[model samples]
Target: MKTRFGKLVCVCAALCLLLSAMFAAGCGNDAHQKKIALVFSHEPQRWTDGAQMMKESLESDGMAVDLLIFHTDEEQAAMLTQAVDEKPDCIVLAGGDIKNFRDSLEKAKEQHIPIVDYDGLTQDTDAVSYYVTFDNYGVGEAMGKYIVQKMNLRTGGGPYSIEFFSGSDTDSNAKLMYQGAYDVLNPYLESGQLRVPSGQSDYAASAIKNWDGKNAEARMKELVANHYQSQPLDIVVAASDGIAYGVIDGLAGYGGTWPLITGQDADKKALGCIQSGKMAFSIQKDPAVLNQKCIRMIKAVVDGSQPEINDVTTYNNGVITVPTYLCLPRIIDKDNLSAVSK
Candidate 1:
């Protein structure tokens, strides 16, 4: 009986060794080296900055990342198709047109490859596994509220002249943001507290094509030539800081008082403008928190673990509602500018 117990102990030790070897070969070393593909339809400053943050975070986690950006929709589709063929651990759609890559993304879904939408919210949420972005409406509401407070409309009886310049019509966030501003400023419009000297108050009507600064500049010029030439405008709600810069340039050509401008995304140029009193303030959406959450989700999905998602109903990407995580936006002004700029 003593000899039999010794043999049993030897067998248990051998089994433990085999399990340790298996873990080291499969989950331990292999899972640490994950390959990720980041594909973008366009390379905007805000987008590229976020991409850099994601790349650094992933690389720090021992991930191999492929960052790709395209100028045309067709280019985006072809590249996404090629990425699907490469079969990286996962593919990140780093801000792009969803309609452009829906088919290729579906192919990925069929192959069980995970897809992440990093700020490019499309109507086709079914093609994406997870969606993440700042609360766009909240960003707009913050700007509207700030403008209202700055104008002192609560106590002042005068009607302030204002113009609204929304971002591109193609961007889904643009609509939500404008709608948020409209929700707050509409009451003032009805009460005759806020007036549009340019008479272009509709969101759709004032949308900047491509969100191009040149186009925005042209529109501002037109607003001046048609309406503000005789007198300086009081306020202009520029949706993005990029658009605000253009508005500022156009106003520079004006012979009247510089108008108050509101913007989102605390880009360097816009921040400088705010410091110089050209712009009022901006809402900043920091990418650090979002990128960290993104890394967590990617790690879970790659390791065959389910990720945590909070919003299941707010975002419907045409085909199906995709699981999402929403990040709140923060208002940035002179009070907090040093924290970021300095």
Candidate 2:
């Protein structure tokens, strides 16, 4: 009888231990089941590369990531809708406005899911969770500073012609970048240190539709034909590398003295151009670095902590000021570009 009791006791203890192990696993499953959705505009290679980095990072943290890529505005809206229907814990938007995704993002509001904007902003609304991007104004300011020094705009002692081309006005970064460039160069323009003989210097007037290089090239050609036919153009400030390519192409066709040109986005072709002395500089906004910052923000959100927001007053999404983490951008010129190549 004692042997029988001992065996029963052992069986009971075994059952209890088994139940405890199962319960612990259940809790762990709940912890690991947290889900996030990554949405990308997918048009620009930069955006796609950044999104991929974010996805890999999130998955490494043991959370499931649903990466959605959309090409058109309508596709973006539909993808957001579908993502919300999945009831994800959070959504990361690479680029686009809340207006295009209003219906779906409203569902996000209803579902209590937060949306993080990466490298760009959507329309201001309660749905916006956090914002991360480079100091866009500073980016253009860097370009402006480089241009001023290269062209001797500050002390050139006379009117030097400069042609300006901005990214699409629809882009928030483009607007801020143009504003930064204007803040620096406008003073020179007003002080008569520089001139735009083509009179195509207005940011609004010089905006590149869709950020297309062809459009920019066409404008560059027009400017060269109408204004620089007989004289050397001192400088041309392009907001992005694609636009810079167009501007350079126009310069090449004009067959005149090459001007000191500046651009953002260290694109391979642009970097080649810089190496060949066709372009002066390109801003290095490393996609992998920006991706890591976004991932850190996501982990913070998931851990129920505030993300590492560095700026609170600068970026307003039209509804309210968004808490932002701005990354400083670096310049890639002939002097230090070898480091990048290595």
Candidate 3:
């Protein structure tokens, strides 16, 4: 009887220990669970895909993620403020006018919530902890170089009529891209190899507000009607696929042959355009790669370790030089369309 009682007690103790272990495993401690807030200024397909990928990747790693998207600057500022109040471990920001977000960024800074500036948000503030984006200048340089080689600018080709379309005025990346292209093309313009028929060569004159397709479309139509009515436009330097689409739409009404157009962001529609021989070439900046880099940075911040960065002196946010990881963009044309289309 004594032996039986002792064995029963041992069994009960074993059961209690197993139950305790199971309970602890089932109910994960909240203290160790990291949280991240992802904020985007707009819901363009690219941004949408990036947000979804980031959310899934972080969540799969046992981290909580809050995905927030806003349409306008005001909406973004408010969303940022709200995210700061929630006190996530880190904030990943993409696409938005950074001027309106200064106060909210400051608040996040005060709260010790690191901000990962995905893509180029602003170069005028040091509120962000890290930045992950493609080399915008290089993207533009690729476009310019492509045009130069195709047009044989180096071999003293005849003067070609060209037009330019830049992104929104608020985006620093736009300026950087414009500068890169302009630096390459300006010499040609000065040497009479390329001429701007519309006289809209400067960024201030060529910028499309909000990078809106409609605005770009309207501008293109106006330029065609006013300037390209007589002279044929040989080339168009569009800063993005959205602007490129606008240029295409603006030219659709006219019966003129499509000019050699250059664009960024190898969007599916733009790739289709390339396949159809409507667009010349586009710069491919894969959002998946960029988002993965951002996830690594966020995880580093959560783990209290130093995140990996490549370029340090390139991105100057006025207050301090932001540490950045630059992903290189590639040109996608009809020859290689099949590779990226899949």
Candidate 4:
């Protein structure tokens, strides 16, 4: 019995050695794969479809990702600092004003941890690794053209007007979208082709949604109450689907249906509203394509490969003009909302 027990112990030791070798090999493989850190402005669930797309696409590329979500600007900066400390192979930042972390981001850059600025953009900074996002100005232009066309269709030969609700002032994405729309719409407004009502008019009263539904609802309510007391509003141009929903809720009790509304993000609820004809249109941007491009940018940096970039608008961080990738935005109206929603 003693001899049998010794033999069993030897067998167990041999198996353990084999297992250790296999585990080491697996660990080495994992280490060989690049490590990526994703720092986002908000929680994943609260993330716009665009954010989700980046996360999914990066993970699909066999790169290990660490996500750090910050709820506030300060928190975002702190996370950026911490990520730099971790010395990740490459760090990806999406959303919010990244301006708060220029110093820390620079530190990471000095350490050779390239940063891929995803979605949101900051004024030319040196910490940016590569920029992967849409042509925000183009998005705004689309909105403007669409609004003009819709107004013409709706009013025929009559006078019509519109209003705007922008995202947070700090968000460059919001600014680009708003500016794009404004540029396109401004000409018509100047030509007297479109008359925005009064300060109380929904089309005239502008509020910052900050990309929060609650904030959007509150702002929309204010617009509704103010406009109802004065003249009726004809159009609402919201920066996002979440903001548009808020406007709809505010208009719910206005004693009349709302005027034509335009939104972006093509969220599920937005799709539903479009189907019912309550919402006029939404710009459809595929999150998958957005994310895939983001990953490509990140992988290029991680693997030390050159990324394809549109240099004209690339962010000139002190070290390099990181490549910027611009995805096109498609407008979705009731005509093809179903196909676009899918």
Clashes of each: 2, 1, 0, 4
* Selected candidate, larger TM-score, 1 vs 3: 3
Tens-place lDDT per residue, model 2, 1-342, is: 999999999999999999999999999898768799999987568889888877887888788999999988888888888899998888888777666888887779888888889888776576788998999989988988887777677676557778889998678788889888888888889988888888877778989987889999999988888888798797888889989988887776576778888888897887899999998998989887788888888888877888998899988877878899999899999998888853
Per-prediction TM-score: 0.85, 0.89, 0.90, 0.80
Candidate 2 residue pairs in backbone clash = 98-123
User: Per-model C-alpha lDDT, please?
Assistant: 0.81, 0.85, 0.87, 0.73
Better of 2 and 3 by lDDT: 3
Compare the candidates by lDDT and give the number of the best one.
3
lDDT of 3 at 121: 58
Candidate 1, residues 270-335, lDDT tens digits: the string is 788778998888888777777777778888888989887878886676677878887888887887
Candidate 3's error at 273, in angstroms?
0.8
In lDDT terms, how accurate is model 3? 0.87
Sorted on lDDT, best first, the list reads 3, 2, 1, 4
By descending TM-score, how would the candidates be arranged? Answer: 3, 2, 1, 4
Query: What is the alpha-carbon lDDT for the whole of candidate 1?
Result: 0.81
